[model samples]
Target: MSPNLLLADESTGSKLRRNLLAVAGTLLLMTTYTVLVITQPTDLTGGLGQGVALATFAAYLLSALLLLAAVLRDLPVSTLTLIPVALGLNILLGQFVGSVMVPLYLDSIGTVLVGFLAGRRAGAATGVLGTLIWSLFAPTVLPFAAGAALIGFLAGTAARFGAVRRVYLAPIAGLVSGVLVGTISAPVAAFVFGGTSGVGTGAVVAAFRSMGDSLLSAVTKQALISDPGDKAIVFLIAAMLVYALPSRMYQSYEFVRRYRVLGNLSGERD
Candidate 1:
């Protein structure tokens, strides 16, 4: 949070119209591509195939966008800006993780960031939106939308429990998030992606499989191995960001009022 987190909405009606128009345009584009896919044969690498892929991608991304539009169109303009930045960060960081083949999927950092700063609905929107946006580049990411949403929702729940306010409790939030996300993601990995996490964490699953463990077990073990500590880092980072926010920004949101990091109201800068 920064003092600049919530810029007042001067032209609320105009902003709403713009948002709706964007949604409409995206839907039209998706429908056009979808119809092309239906009328044309699937080409694994041809133009029509690309159109099919584009249509599917657009549809998936559109769902997330519509959800955000429906639930978060009323958010502060600054927050709307923050969301794009967070989504980009999530994708960039996720790519970095994939390149290194790290066991962790810290991509949900953006989702957690939004939830911590703006509460659950904002957080959920960020998670879903970020994941869908990420999928545009890496279709393999399409299956993990639920896991991303899990991180955002749990991060908000943790904040509500005063985890973000107290430094000591922050790691607890991460640990809890890790456990839940890992459990939730394991099945997705096993079924949707065939236990191949498309990251270095696949090495962990392979090792388990070599030991004669089942695919689901291997994936679950892999998640358990990496998710808890990974999510803990994510939570700690979000808490730190909150701590670094300016007083006005920190205190502006109603959901975070229960936390006492700022001590006294008079202590904040005017």
Candidate 2:
């Protein structure tokens, strides 16, 4: 009957709702990721040697589980973004390019982004944990993964210090991260799979060769290359979707932050 008692009851209900939503969202992500991994096209490809194929499959499964755990733990956004991007890159490269470039998508960019937002210690820890996990199952990805982690840490640290906000700096960060991801992945592939030269020579050479061939063919065909057009279109559609959506979710996030719901709930429990 007291006002304070009524407030307490309402807070308890809010806490329960938040927890339930979080749990439900995590379960959905886990199920979707699991199905995606199982049905991935690469799993059917016969190019990878049997040993490599099996190892890769297991690694992917574990990575999916790890990503799911990260989501459940409410890991930083940068870290969360890494999962879909990594998976997308993997699928794209595997289907269009080749497995030789698999390591390039080891979630370095996302880690770096997270570090930038959260600070060095958290960023570095995320990188280190990601690297260790990738190494355990895909040792061939170690060099690239390590390079990605380091780049992420540096980028994050620099962002924290306000060095990352400059327009020029952002592209530089992306370039450095991409190069590191590509370079590191190449050597690891050579070492773990054998019969390949280090990343410096082989991977770079292959990339250049591929670029040259594509450019020549495109020129010969008189195809005007508008690289940003497709990307712009995609982004426009995404923006429209976000704009069209109701703002309830955004409002809810603001409400929680404004009210410090998590803090309040914990204090109540204590």
Candidate 3:
């Protein structure tokens, strides 16, 4: 075998190892999070049992599988990374912070990020699959999944037209996608899981009423007081930091290529 072929094999092996390690780390993080969330001490905490927990595990497994498939198929790493991060963070936030404002917002951000990076077809596929997995825990997430797929398709198309690559444009895309997905999800969640009764027909009307009341209350409360907790603020900062790192690394990689940095550093004789 030629030296070039040997180098290619070595690089491929390294990447495979990195990808496998990333997946393993993600699984460990998610599993730890799920156990903590489902075994919380309060009755009102809505802890899922073994069956649901297993399902949640399966969801992450599916997400990993999807990401691995994307890698094998030569999709961009930006697109694939979103799945593991989203799954891990969603569980973490839900466990530590509860499924209140932050978790929902983060979920929106994740979906939008995936949609932005992957383009419409892949984005839609990932969004639908990811959302379906999430639905195992919260069935009301279905509409959000559907809406995300639509938004992703639009965003992907816009990206092709150069409307999504700009930094200024990204937040706009994210906001629009968030609003569309969130609106549909909010109603469905309210309708499906808002009531005190069991998850069925008799609870539907009460669920809707309660959800309307909560929405009104949230608006009023937000207008009156803004009390963001330290934990939430910290988590937000951390998330931003984490998201920015990948882009920065990608830029560094580009710079290295442009300057032939890696080529020159290697001391191999011709």
Best by TM-score: 1
How badly does each model clash, as a count of residue pairs? 0, 1, 0
Q: Rank the candidates by lDDT, best first.
A: 1, 3, 2
For model 1, residues 42-73, the per-residue Cα lDDT tens digits are: 24346754555555445544544554565566
The RMSD (Cα, Å) of candidate 1 is 8.8
State every prediction's TM-score relative to the real structure: 0.67, 0.34, 0.39
Model 3 clashing residue pairs (backbone): none
Regions of model 2 farther than 4 Å from truth? 1-106, 143-145, 175-270
lDDT tens digits, residues 59-112, model 2? 433433333333334444444554444334333433443356532222344454
Give lDDT: candidate 1, residue 142. 72
The CA lDDT at 75 in model 2 is: 46
Rank order (by TM-score, best first): 1, 3, 2
Report lDDT (CA) for all predictions. Answer: 0.68, 0.39, 0.42
